[model samples]
Target: MDPPSSSSSERWLWWMDDEKKHSIADTIDIEKSEDGEKIDARKERIRDCMTVLGGFLSIMATGGAINSVGLLQTHWENNQLREYSPQTVGWIAGTNIFLSLFVPVLAGPVFDRYGHIWILAVGSGLFVVGLFIISFFDNHSAAPVTLGMMISSWGVLCGTGYGLIQTAVPGVICRRFDRRRGLANGFSSLGNSVGGVLWPMLLRVALERLGWSWSMRAIDGLALVMLAIGNGLMWGSGVPAVGIAARPEPESSDNEKNKEEQEEEGREPSLTWGQCIRDGARCFRKGDFVWMTASLAIFQFVVMGVAGTLPSWGQQQGFEDASLFFYVVAVVNAGAAAGRVVVGSISDSLGRFNSVIIVQTMVVIVGFGIWHNVGTNERLLYVFAALWGFSNGAILGLWSPLVGECVHTPAPDHIHAIIESLRLLTELVCGVSRLCDVENFGRYLSAASSVVSIAGLLCVPSSAQILGTLGPDIHVIFFGTLLILSLMFMVMARVTFTGYSFKIWRVV
Candidate 1:
């Protein structure tokens, strides 16, 4: 072959690059075509549907671990840390709950930008490590680790891992499902309820047979097995790969090129972090986002608070049998699981906002009408747990779809979804704070929870303080009031977004 001229070599390289670009483009097109075809496929072939079962199980594991903190809290109080104040012990579980909720804000963006594999890998590792750490901690040692130390090791570490997985799983479903998005989300959320039901019984059994340390280890082992299986399923799901760039089409001719150049010059530059912050601030200023955020925040604050405290409250109610006390938590969660499926399925038909309103109304009625009056009557307490659990579960299941509806712009974009997700996740941080006893323990726990109808807003220590100082009757009233206020906010959000027409049953 004769030596090519520089111009000819340049032409050859350009042609190669063009060929490569076309190949990339073709790959993307094939991927998109496959996605579309899968969307139209029979239910069995849909990757999203295939993964839903695994995702549900993954979420069930996550929820089980997170919600099981109540059982752990009760165990620690009654067995491991009898001398410690309830408020002091409460921080351990509270921090775990707080971090699990808050870390999702950070995780969501990452999940959106990256795919599930690395996130799941890191999350599973951290989650397993956190569980192992909790399992190995020995209270009988010469220098027993303090409650604060446990919080750092178990709460922060495990919670972070939980947050990563929790955020990623739902984001996967969100990207996968379109027509059945609500139902898909609902199924995933049902995992939390399932966890709530199963973990208590499991933990109680472990506590009875294995003791606290070994019980944690047993749970850890279960988590390890489940996460391994879930991770495998996730790896195989063939969800879209991230970070691939789509090739821009070639511009034709000088006049066309000139128009494109001019349009590019006119377009807004990519957003800077400062600009994004400013934009998010502006979005939050809008009434719809604010009200929706507030309602969601209050609901989470109350529900999580209640969930964390419920086992302890059952103990305080003179439920001497530890098994029964744990079962109370299970019953509530069981009801919630049922609610998640039923409410989630219906939300697609009934307006998301309307469904939430109905659920919240039921929560208020349960909190005040049933929960407030239930004394030592075990049957009534179980009834209250069932009703409250169902209503609250429905709220949790519906909130995501509701937020999606409220913040949804006409033409959907990643930035908008990220903003909405961030807003919703960030708002839950407020509820997380309410789970622990900060400086304003009694007032914040009692007043905010009551006003917002945050069901289980009382931290263990604070619940102890309130139950001791103010009485359980007062605590019940606080929760009832919180439910009432939460109901009002839900109503306000619905009215603000959907208008006053009763005919519009479906808000989302």
Candidate 2:
């Protein structure tokens, strides 16, 4: 009745149980027992929902646009940029992809020191403004889109905007939700898939009737609306309305507990930039964290190849119509949307690392078995797109939750001391349970993104060369092989974290 005052494990179980006991009668009983506590809990739940909504809308604008790059590439090559080679055009997309990921290195630390509101506002402005500027440079205009124009607007401005939004959205989620983090992230990530499907369809229709100039503007208008609503909801939502109690590490000493309480009471000093950098650096030292980053980086390379080139490969196989490529992109994103929700839900019970290992196997299978063999058959290509999208979506959606787990995991060497430090850090930064150090999460996320951005920068351009010099068949083989290697790293990460003991299968 009075919010569980028992041990941390029992408190955690109580929260889970309370979630299940959802009924009007139960609500009435809770309110009757403690009006103030019940009201606070209700407010917290509402804020959590708002945070998820904000994340979904924000991701739809940013990540969803990124997902639609393949469609944009097809448009550019066919119409305005037909004179250039695929490899050359790829540099534009590569630049966008690179900035979208790489700018997070700066955004993450800035987010920790500042907050999310201004970051979201600035990012949304840049992204929308870039889109508007690009519309004027469309083939319909006097000054058609040039390499410099494309790179400057989409690559530099929009990409930097995306990086900032992406960093802030997840940081807020990590602070608010703990046990249900995977599910929350999954729901938020679903926005990208939805955006992927919607953007292509809208662009296809607009391109047919309105032409390229208005099509870009139309989507930019929609993006502006979505981003505005997202920013409004996300502002001032980082700190949880109710304190989520976390079980202290069993090894924590009384002094450590005292320090944690003091930090929770807002006595902790403002973290210096050096301290922020040092904390993020510590993540690299953990075997599991390092292995996990490598796994994600390699798999990201695979994803970039598939997302950027699959439609082009279809065009090469005699399906030249842009309309059909639109359908292909849509189907893949539809499958991805389903996968994010389904996989995120299951990861809570099955374990984050285990869920990735399972899904990534399918990624490998689809890459080698399905995509490699599909040549001229339109139906087979569609099938491959769907399967690839679904499996790949699951793997991509798990990265945030996996990173959260790694940050929370006790360091391999220090054990007790690191646990205490992390606990203190969590309370000091987020005023929530032992999920992750919210202030430092951006940097860890940035570290992972650093590797991913490199993959993004190279995968499309390099794959285009492979497509030209060799063939789509050889490109598939290369992509599939990378997936296999990444899968191995995933297993290594799991083992390194849980160890070789019987506790290997423990819900990690």
Candidate 3:
């Protein structure tokens, strides 16, 4: 005989052990046909896209409230808590910001294990409850009680809820889309910009007409409806399938043992809580990741600081009309929403790192070139608001995709965990920095631009005091320096990933 036929050989192997033969046969039976697998994969992608849409709604609601804090700050100052110092009132908003940034570090892992629905459910409930509580204590006489309610309900409860939703939604997106991740992430992040734009205008009108009490209840009611829709969409999408690419079976007997070994190697062992902590700590030890984290931290610190204080800055510059001051925030956010969608789509072609570099450069020019000499020119201020918002908004929108690119990993949970941890650390630093010097609010804004720039505050009476003195504007100098530093670190990260090749189109 020439040689045993392949079928004969398999039959011989099958007869050697009945249990092993059945196990092998069952595995083969369970494996999908080629066309069937493709069909399933297409279905999964469609589901994931729907899930992303749900995530967008969730972010829109939470991001709206967070971004609208400026309006609330103005309301407190002009109305309910006008008797209190700005510093005292600022802490209420500051606490909420701090918690929103910081809680995600812990929530990321919980979301990975538990799934998105319950996390979102609890978050939605807390957000609604927080707003309701605040509504009850809106009277000026209950200023002290309102402050307590704001901190407990809005700051701790609502912030934590937003943090959970924010963390879980990104995790969902990261797992679902690989090829078109930039577009997916960008679209989802648009929730923040849209929320920022709409909420400020709504709150402005509510404050003017309804007073603080009804305004709080109206917002609460709105959040409840949006969140219900979001939760429903998320529930329908189901949990995302984990890991990168699915493995194909070995074609030959010689490869079977190797394939088994590869499978064993790829399997991630469950980690204890201590091991998880240790693993998170180990990520910081990597030089490239550390630089990436630093860049993100500095960017957030600078942008949030300036954006948060824009209303006050406009007022101080003699925009006496409350409506005009509120409009400044809305205009910036509207530009931000537009920038997020446009730049995000462009990044798919230009490359994420290249897009980030260009935007950062634009921010530097806008801060120094336009904003520095804006003075009391209302038109110039609006121009600065539009350009700065658009460029800065792109930075926030692009960062998730950039972080995904820099970290060399196929596991979405691991990547998300790392991102959340870095964000928490960045926010913690920003929050503490803001809280320390609440007295000179302008100095806090300057200090937020860069760690080095905060030193500039020591000698100057205020941010405005050093504006014309040190070139056309001190704030621009501080912001530009931060952007330069952030750009340097980002380039270092890019170089580590793709080497120094200007011709290379995509670094990731």
Which candidate tops lDDT? 2
List candidate 1 stretches off by more than 4 Å. 1-50, 138-144, 241-276, 408-465, 498-508
Report the lDDT tens digits of candidate 1 across residue range 1-508. Answer: 3333444323334435656755665676688889987867755455666678778877777778777676777666766677777677777776676667656655544564567888888888888888787666546342247565678766788877887888778767766777887677777767787887888888877777987788878888888888888887766776765611111334667867755764564322233445544543444433444566677766776776676667677666666665776778888889888887788778777778878888888888888888777777889989998888888778876655565565543322233565556545654663311111122221222222222222222344455556546666787777667667877876766644533323444444
Output the better candidate (1/2) by TM-score.
Answer: 2
User: Lowest-scoring 10 consecutive residues by lDDT in candidate 2?
Assistant: 241-250
Residue ranges of candidate 2 with Cα displaced over 4 Å: 1-48, 140-145, 174-183, 236-262, 266-275, 408-443, 500-508
Better of 2 and 3 by lDDT: 2
Per-model CA lDDT versus the true structure: 0.66, 0.77, 0.66
Once model 2 is optimally superposed onto the true structure by TM-score, how far is the C-alpha of residue 241 displaced, in angstroms? Answer: 14
Q: Is candidate 1 or candidate 2 better by lDDT?
A: 2
Q: What TM-score fits each model?
A: 0.74, 0.77, 0.71
In model 3, how large is the Cα lDDT of residue 131?
82
For candidate 2, lDDT tens digit of each residue in 15-48? Answer: 4555553453355556666988888899888988
Tens-digit lDDT string for candidate 3 (1-508): 2332344334545444656765665565456456688899898887877887888888998898888776676666667777776556666666666667656656655665566667788888888888888887666787787777767887788877887787777767766677876567767877888888888888888878998789889988888888888888777776643322233434557666755665665422334667655644544544445566667667765676565556655666566677886777888888888788788778878888778878888888888788777787888988988988898778877765665554443222223565556645754664311112222222222122233222211212232233323433455677678878988887765543443333445534
